[model samples]
Target: MTESYLLGIDVGGTSIKMAIFSNDGDLMEKWSIATNKEKDGEYILEDISVSVKEKWQEMDLQANQFIGAGVGVPGFVDIEHGTIDFAVNIGWRDYPISSILSQHLGLPVVVDNDANLAAAGEYWRGAGVDAEDLILLTLGTGVGGGIIVKGDILHGVAGMAGEIGHVTMIPEAGSPCNCGKSGCLETVASATGMVRMARETIEHNTNSRLYQIWQENGEITTKDIFACAENNDTEAVTIINNAMYYLGLATANIANVLNPEKIVIGGGVSGAGEDLLRPLRFYYDTYALPKVKEHSTFAVAELGNDAGVAGAAWAAKTKAK
Candidate 1:
């Protein structure tokens, strides 16, 4: 008998990652390619189809051995309709992803927002493996969130369940977000948000070391801010602390509503390790209800970039089951 496999695709603004997984949930092979978002959606699908077929051929595998394909797209998705409502970063709107891909590949396809899949990936095989309820926060260019309840991704009425980034943290501070809200959590707690805060600090506090680094680099970035923080620069640490305060506030709000077992943080900024987690934990514990805090713990994501792909595969397998 031949073993069945699942193909998982994680489509992002910059790159698309693909993975093959056994029915038992073990990854078999994985690869990635740059995503030309400027191109038409059909062009992107063509590229993916060719790449997936090439991968299958290289492995000397028959199409019948493959079970199904699952995709995690960076956009507002209607999972039931398999349509991408919008992807501002990629400039796609209302793309019928599932129908197009199924027509091209002759296999059933499942689609959902990438962050939700990342949450599912963590809940199934990563940090939240032992927990029944969890939430994942991806702190990248923007803060993205996913809420998992009872071992399932919670897709609210419109399938926009876990959009925690837009949660209001400040009523009248910071620049406006793409969502047209000022002082939204993502505007203050994300990598881009941190850079914005760091720039403001550099302008006001001339004595800070970050100003020197920014002067040398011609501009301040999240990396420079984190590096300065690592070197114990007061200004950088202060900026990070400010960001963490909002993050903690957001976590506390989520906890009060859902009371998850774990809150998993991921993305590039998470590389700061304790420097970020410690302050976040501090604020979370301070603001969260004592009972909610007692049940939930904060941790870094284990799967890193692979979380989306792994989650897509796991989702396909789960749907099949």
Candidate 2:
């Protein structure tokens, strides 16, 4: 009997990460291709198709050996319709990515939101493994969120349920957010938000290490903030504490309702490791109800860049069954 293979594709604004997995969830091969954005990304899926065919031929694998392909799309995914309602980065609007990829690759395709895929990946093989309920918070240039309830990704009616970044943290007199909101969690906790906080701190206290670095380099990064805080810089520590406070509040609120088994933190900021977790847990403990807090745990995502691709493979395997 021939072994079955699964194809996983994660489409980002800049590149497409692709991987082949075995039936039992072992990763076989992985690679990436530049995302062609010519004509408003019209050819992105076509490029993926060509690459997959080349890869399969290189490996001497027949198309019939594959179960199907799953794609983690970066935007509002309408799972039921197999379309991306809108993806500003990819320049797709209500585009039928699933059917189109299925036609191009001659295999059934499943498409889901990229953030949700990352969470699903963690749930299946990373930090949230063995947990029936969990939430993922990714802190990058911007923040992204995903929720898993009862071992399945939650896609609200509008496919916008787990937008934790856009959750209102400071509703009034708060900083502006890219989502056209005021004082969103993204504006307070994302890398960009950390920089924004640094700028604000420097303006008031130009004598601090954060201000000195900002003035010297004309910029400050989240790493700079963390470093300064490590040296006991009061302003830097305050900014980090404030950001984690909001995160904890939101986590507490979510836990109160969903009572997830774990809340997994991922992305670049998570590189702070102990520094981030310690403070975040401190705040979470301060806010979360005793009952829910006792049940919900915290973890850092084990999978790094592989989360999306892994989740895509899971989607394919799940749908194939």
Candidate 3:
């Protein structure tokens, strides 16, 4: 039997990931290209469309072999209208992404927020596989999240249900966030936030390893902080503790309400692995209700960069139904 394929596209601010997967979710081929954001991102759709055609031809595949395409966008989405409500990073507003991409590919296309799809990807194939309800946090340059309830992505009424990063953790005189809010969880638990915290506390711990590293490199990374914290560097441990505290607190609050089966953590910072999970779990236990903490488990995402594409492919499969 000739196999059908699903085209998965993950559109990020830095690059776009494209993958070909069997309708059953086996990854056949995958590659990435730099995101061209010129002219208000007018070229992104065309670039993706052209690239997919090239890859399809390279694989000796015909158009009819494809069931559909699913795209993950890094912005607020109007799932009902298949348009981007607004994406400040991509400079898109009221843009019809689904129709345009579909027209270009001659296939039905489905679109969703990038982070939400990542969560769905995790739930489908990664660490959250066994769980029907899950929460996924992507701790990158900023924070992003997706919530799954009984296996479907929860978009709420406005398709903004999983903006976990923007949840207010500090309401009074806290650092301002890109979302025009003060003291958002993103301002504490994200890489940017951790780095900022390191800089602020470095002076106070001038005799510590963290301060010494800062003096040598003039900067410190979340990785450096985690490594130092593991080695018992006071400042670094403090930074990690403080940031993960907010993360735990935020998730604990959310988990208290949702009582998800698993909470998956991904992104660059999560690469710290046990170093990150240790303090994070401690604080989560502190803030979460005893039953919720006991029942919900935390995990690291397994798919890495492949997650978005996998999630998008899964979304494509659903669109076919």
Candidate 4:
């Protein structure tokens, strides 16, 4: 008898991460490939299937040894049909990801939004493990999030639930977001948004340390901003504080409704660790209702980039069960 495994795939804008996990959920092997975005992303799924086949051969595993596959995609996913409604980054529209992958791999495939899988990953084996309910916020180039309620993902009526990034933060005189909206939470809390804010601040306050760093590096990043703020740069501190305000507001609102046990923050920006969490918790406590404030604990996500793949694998395991 051959040992069984599960395949997990995380599809991002730049790369596709694939992982193999034992039936008992231990990671076996993982790798990544460039995302072939040419020609409307028609080749992406085929590339994934081919990669899986190669990996299976390399591992010398029997075809039937793999129980199933799960995928996490960066788009609005329709779970019922295993189709992606739209993923601008990957240039996909109504793409039948699950069906194609299933047919190619000869295994059941489950698909979902990447952020949702990140949440699931955290809930299963990362920061929120053991929690029946939790939420995950990915604060990177763009803010993305997922909500899990009672061990299940919260897919709203339109399958866009847990989209905390789009929550309006500034109704007027706010920056425009990629979602075609102005003053969205993403416009202020995301890495891209934070860089934009830093640039704008530099225009008026050239004397700040952040301006000096930007002049030397020729670009300002979310990491630079956080580092400068840690060094007590006035401008950097103010910018981070502003971003935290909106982030806290959105998270608190969600907590009020879901009352999750843990709220896990992830992505590049979250690498700041305590520097980010302390202030974020301050604002979250300020805005969340009394019950929400009392119940939910904040923590940084532990799975990092592996969250998506881990969660995807978890999804496959659950679907197979």
Clashes of each: 0, 0, 0, 0
Model 3 lDDT per residue over 188-291, tens place: 99999999998888666677787888889978888888888878887788888899989999999999999999999999998998888988899899999999
Local accuracy of candidate 1 as per-residue lDDT tens digits, 65-103: 877788999888998888899977777789998888877
| TM-score to native of every candidate shown | 0.95, 0.97, 0.96, 0.96
Clashing pairs in 2: none
**Comparison by TM-score, 1 against 2, better one:** 2
Compared with the true structure, all predictions reach lDDT values of 0.87, 0.89, 0.90, 0.91
lDDT of 2 by residue, 113-203 (tens): 9999999899988999989899999999988999999999998888898999998999899998898888999999999998898898888
Lowest-lDDT window of 10 residues in candidate 4? 312-321
Once superposed on the true structure, which residue ranges of model 2 sit more than 4 Å away at CA? 1-3
Largest lDDT belongs to which candidate? 4
Those runs of model 3 whose alpha carbons end farther than 4 Å from true positions after fitting are 1-3
In Å, residue 42's CA in model 3 sits off its true spot by 1.1
Alpha-carbon lDDT of model 2:
0.89
Q: Which window of 10 residues has the lowest lDDT sum in candidate 3?
A: 202-211
Q: Kindly list the per-residue Cα lDDT of model 4 for residues 69-89, writing each as its tens digit.
A: 999998889998899999989
Among all candidates shown, the one with the greatest TM-score: 2
The CA lDDT at 219 in model 3 is 82
Per lDDT, what order, best first?
A: 4, 3, 2, 1
